[model samples]
Target: MNVAFDKPSPWQRIQPVFQGFDLPLVFIVAFLCGLGLVNMYSVGFDNGSRFFDQARNMLLAAGVLFLVAQVPPQRLMALAVPVYTVGVLLLVATALFGLTKKGATRWLNLGLVIQPSEVMKIAAPLMLAWWFQRREGQLRPLDFAVACGLLLVPVALVLKQPDLGTSLLVLSSGLYVIFFAGLNWRLILPVLLAGAIGITLIVSYQGDLCQPGVKWVGLHDYQKNRVCTLLDPTTDPLGKGFHIIQGMIAIGSGGVTGKGFMQGTQTHLEFIPERTTDFVFAAYSEEHGLVGNLLLMAGFLALIFRGLVIAAQAPTLFSRLLAGSLSLSFFTYAFVNMGMVSGILPVVGVPLPFISYGGTAMVTLGLALGMLMSIAKSRGLMQR
Candidate 1:
């Protein structure tokens, strides 16, 4: 009366690890990664191993995403405080004795050079989400104020390092969590209105404000130059304005159907600056045209939509807040990168996600996608 038992085959043993994964999300990421690879071959062929390096970066990121996805939402919540604390401490260390390249002190050497602010991109939102989750049934204005304090600490530190792009990203991540936590619109409208008013004033008086000796309050000289350059690139056609001007030309030359792959004159002629990194969008636009841009935008929109769906179905408050914030964080990255490249926003150090060639940014994106998948998997498990 004994029953025979058989050992599981390799595929059978590994099957459970793949279960509950969000397939739609995986498909979207693969689609974007495919675009990235195609783009690198065209724009980075002569950049000395950029194509292969990007390929390797993608593989590493995939590994990170897979490992992160295995952790449940509860364990993620437990790691939130420690991550945020260490991120803030690293920012402090960066300020005190960090390495500086091209006049910005944003990287620290902890046996390996690292940008601590990137850590805040995820930690800020996680910390805020954790705060709200702790007071889930008893939220108050004071709790939000405490959340703001937690957010602004890292933001101010990063700003002190004169890294406007990273600081804005960190601020937006925390703000998204706060908004999702039911902060009243009455408290948000005034800030938006004031920002609008400030922009109008800057636009109306650019001539006077952009003077050689003009010192804008709360902005570094380089930051002020970027804003002024955005207002009028013609003033410094060969200097500060060269990047925007070249970027616009490449994008405009792409037309409706593009110049075809690797046929981008502007890209091949080296007219586009940072053609594989921050300005990669311009190169992509030139080679792929408006249709390609549309498809790329649609893919990003799908990623955001799926993330929101996962957030809506998450089992806990922390999961919902973190998922929702991370989803919109992708929106922020795409919007800011595209806007800056299109000349609608000032040039910054932000890189286009998945398409841009940067090891650190790719890893950050992987961590975010992994968390989203983890939340999605948790929801599926609960349903059973």
Candidate 2:
């Protein structure tokens, strides 16, 4: 008797590709991406073929998420050190003979110019998490010191690149790793208090500190300008403040329900700066209004909450720390961008995550989400 079994259909064969995919996380991401595309169409209608290009970028990001999710946490842990080492080496090389544009030496010209700091966004947390996991039960003050040293080296290098946004991100990523790895709140309280006091002092002495020829300590000229502009944008209305002024105007002009999609005067008239990039929140605010803003915030909240849940469920310390850091880092990116656009924080040129148009950033975000998916998937596999 020759009995031939039927081959599994292609759908069945490929179905397992998404077998452990987190449905809620996927929905949240897709929802945010869809909203992003809609807003991009409105903001970039006359900015060339950006909408199509963004569509392509989204596809690319989706592909990255899928491909990366396939890698297990054990494998990711294995790659952490090498990835971080290479990233740091690239940053050092950039410092030596890197490409510079607009006075910022941030890109590496290895045939195709690339920003090494962007890679450190993921690498920093990965390396820190892996380190903490190795010392798991044997963690000591010295171990924490070593971990902070690992983190600061890359962060300082990125800052030397003069990319404050990336520096803030890398800093937060590593901090989250430490925080998750059992850093005591006794230590956290002092830092938070110091930050609060510093802000108070800055606000109190803004007039004196922001005077022409009065140099602010530690901050670069442009960095000082950003803080001063945030304090009082009218001080440099037509110069360094134009972007903030335009952004605030768009956000306020949206009223309660917005001007109705693509109906924003500030957006269509190009009154908003960097409409499709750093100031995307302004364009989105102008077109979508409060209702749209609420929905967008809701999407981000969902993503953040889901990430924490995944971290809570992670089967290993490495997964938990890395997932938590990446998730909170996403929230930080959104909150900082929104705060800057609304004139409450300094304009550090960070994009609005999924809603902004940029291939490189989107790819980074995809890698982040992929890591989260891998954690979720690993949990599922162990359950089975």
Best by lDDT: 1
List, residue by residue over 105-160, the lDDT tens digit for candidate 1: 99999899899999999999999999999999999899999999999999999999
Where does the lowest 10-residue lDDT sum fall in candidate 2? 210-219
Model 1 root-mean-square deviation: 0.9
Model 1, 224: alpha-carbon shift in Å? 0.7
In terms of lDDT, model 1 sits at 0.95
Reference-based TM-score, model 2:
0.98
- Models 1 onward score TM values of 0.99, 0.98
lDDT of 1 at 107: 93
Per-model CA lDDT versus the true structure: 0.95, 0.94
TM-score of 1: 0.99
Candidate 1: where is the Cα deviation over 4 Å?
none
Clash tally for model 1: 0
Candidate 2 achieves a global lDDT of 0.94
